[model samples]
Target: MKLLFCVYLSVLFFSLFSCQNDKRVENENSLSIQREKSKLVVEYRILSNVKYLEDRNCIEKLASCKNPKAEVRFLFPKNISELGLDTAYQEDSYFIHQLGVFNKPIFNEDENYRIYVMTFDYMVSLVVFEDKRTKNRTFTITGKAKGIFWINSSYWIVGNDCHMGCSMSIERIKDPKLLKPTKEQNLDSLRKQLQRLPYEEKMKIVRQEGDELLFSANDTLYNGIGKKLSGFIPYQNSMILVFEQYKSNKYRFIQVNEDKSVEHIDSLVNGKFDTRQFSEDDMITILPKNQSLISLCQTIFKIENDTLFVYSLR
Candidate 1:
């Protein structure tokens, strides 16, 4: 009888302890969780497209249609009142995707600038806005796409034009290979386009390319315009490359000799090579501007479809 009584007491005590543990667990479960709101307000965002590239970013080929869009975004917080960024916005259209600040202010504004490459696909640019505000601003370069970015601190483009193809990977600017330009592919396309145009239009594009190849605001002649250039002059002296800023109605050719003296020929029409009426065909071959010198002081030129047989005497 004593043993049975002890056993019953132990069982009753153990049950009470188990009940208390269960009640403690229930109380903990009933407690509410404390939460804190995030203080980040996105200021703006940028987006772009990416395409598959090969041949060291030189040769371009369509890889069964695997091109996708990529993006670089700028995020700002809400607390800065003097900087009136009222909202953030994003939109996707058939050809482009637009991302920017939306007026729905959420978190405290931050002055710190952050850039993110938010997409996995190879990033490419359909078109880039020449934002004057960002022209002088410097950006710290980081992330997977190093030299792949189109814009520099001074707003110079250091990547492929995407005309031929762009390398999915890019080396740091310090590398010698950086900014070499996939010239064969890019220039070939440009050359073909220029050939179909009239003489005046061709000159215009050449000048435009000169401006595009500028390294900085003050650079003079780092342009790729000279790529198609060759020596000219049917006489003893070699003919130097010439140029004219393309306009709707007029153009000029510049020739230089060993002495660095400039000879501005007005038109390919024997004398007034640079100055011509808009109506004239100017069947001038502007590129491959070469002249053959058969003898000392005697050079031969096939000009304007042999309409002008130019000869030189020393």
Candidate 2:
């Protein structure tokens, strides 16, 4: 097939890297970006006492430091667009950056927005900013390629850790920018078709159209809560709560009614088309073609600063 899948991943990578010789990571300099004097709170359901952060990069080495290479130059967050704020999500064919530190909360005590999505490259290539004090912006919208093993996006695709005598393959990317997913195998075939089903009424999820592979025949449809949409404003309307009135109010879409009432809903993501192409990676990909948005997306929401964080996965 692909040379018998690279000779069956070189006999499963030395029998799984010699029984997973992990040795507590923290190796260093495969890339390098460590600048987090503070930021690692974790746990946040929307807001029952909010908190969320745990980026961990270094190409999924889980940021013990190292992640983002091409030798590191413009890898990410160097003054992130000068923080003029309001770019919420940028993905010029994969230089990604979703910034929104807004009122500051890189570690908490919130005003909200501790989001900072950063993906390095996939290349259509072009960068000629001869600095007139001009920061880089360049461009590229869709040259296809962002990430999913060959690392990058959100991270971790490391796989094949069967106790190291390793020979499982699929990490090859000696550079060409990155991402060469070679057919992601739909979440590894929906984790082997969810091990023949019935894991407590189902919960598999690969659907975001990256290549279907679903399941949710009712774990009460994900009962209640779930977060990670990243850096303010991620409304797709499974029932209500939308925003985007100011800052480039591209066709309205409010809806804050409780009693104070006010419900507009104009061009919802360009005329009723919100498959949600935004991602600072709170990693959510379960729309199994919309079965009432899988129990209202487990009912979550979090729009900071202007405040509005709800939760309900139960």
Candidate 3:
């Protein structure tokens, strides 16, 4: 009887332990699936193709010129319409489109030549250029784009310059079912959360004659009307806000408002610039300081020299 009772108790104990383990495993699996489903999906398409210039010397000269370090470099004739693809160039703004893979020249001529390159993933064309004069001067302009795309899928399109440098913009191929918060929504939520704090806590964040609110990490209080916040700085505790504050006239003030509204409060030197709504994190702002231009995340703002900078405990 004693041996039978022992076996029954042991079995019951094991059964309960197994049930708990199974529940934990199931929860973990559910979380993993949710994470996977929330990821954004993107697709790319190319839209147009054409051959514009045909001069062999022009083509060889342009191609042989060292590729610019920047992405989306543009070389335009002083008289762009002289290139002869007047209609296409006009429609696409001097034939400026997204840059893509370049193929070796298929043919060359003294007056005209042809080289193949992918303008976008979808549109591949052979461009032909001819010069009437021996001095065929062209201007090259280059810039970069920064954005996000899907890892597993090709989200770039041809016909327009799409991906440049570290920047890539993606269009959704399929609706992303994830519930990510927008800037406004996140700001509102944070505001509500902050409102729930004691008035003393809120008062600690007030700065610049009560025009701005700040949250600090090291118990320092910063105050200014045009103070800047660092771009999209994530909080470490997931409860605190991490940002950079403006120090002088050289910076712009970026604020994540109580309502989750992000804006640029431009420097007084820039003529009392108001804040503009930005939806994404890829945007950057350039500020002209004394002699050099400083580039920083759009989240920071410049303030008056007299305003005191404050920091507070999160």
Global lDDT scores for all candidate models? 0.21, 0.21, 0.22
Provide TM-scores for the models. Answer: 0.17, 0.19, 0.15
What's the residue-level lDDT of 45 in candidate 3?
17
Which tens-of-lDDT digit does each residue in 248-306 have in candidate 1?
Answer: 22223333222223343434322212111101110111111122211011112233331
TM-score result, candidate 1: 0.17
- In model 1, the Cα lDDT at residue 272 comes to 18
Which candidate would rank higher by TM-score, 1 or 3? Answer: 1
The C-alpha stretches of model 3 lying farther than 4 A from their native spots are 1-259, 263-266, 271-314
lDDT of 1 at 152: 24
Runs of candidate 1 with Cα error greater than 4 angstroms are 1-235, 240-242, 266-290, 293-314
Superior candidate under TM-score, 2 versus 3: 2
Error of 3 at 95 (Å): 20
Q: How many steric overlaps are in each model, in order?
A: 29, 26, 48
Tens digits of lDDT, candidate 3, 1-314: 99786565344322221222321233112212211111111121111121222311111122323553113212222232342212222111111222223322221222221111221111112111222253231110011112111212211111111111011111111112111212232322333454365534433322112111111111112233323322222111111111233444233333322222333333223221111212121121111111011112111211223221211100
Instruction: Give lDDT for model 2.
Output: 0.21
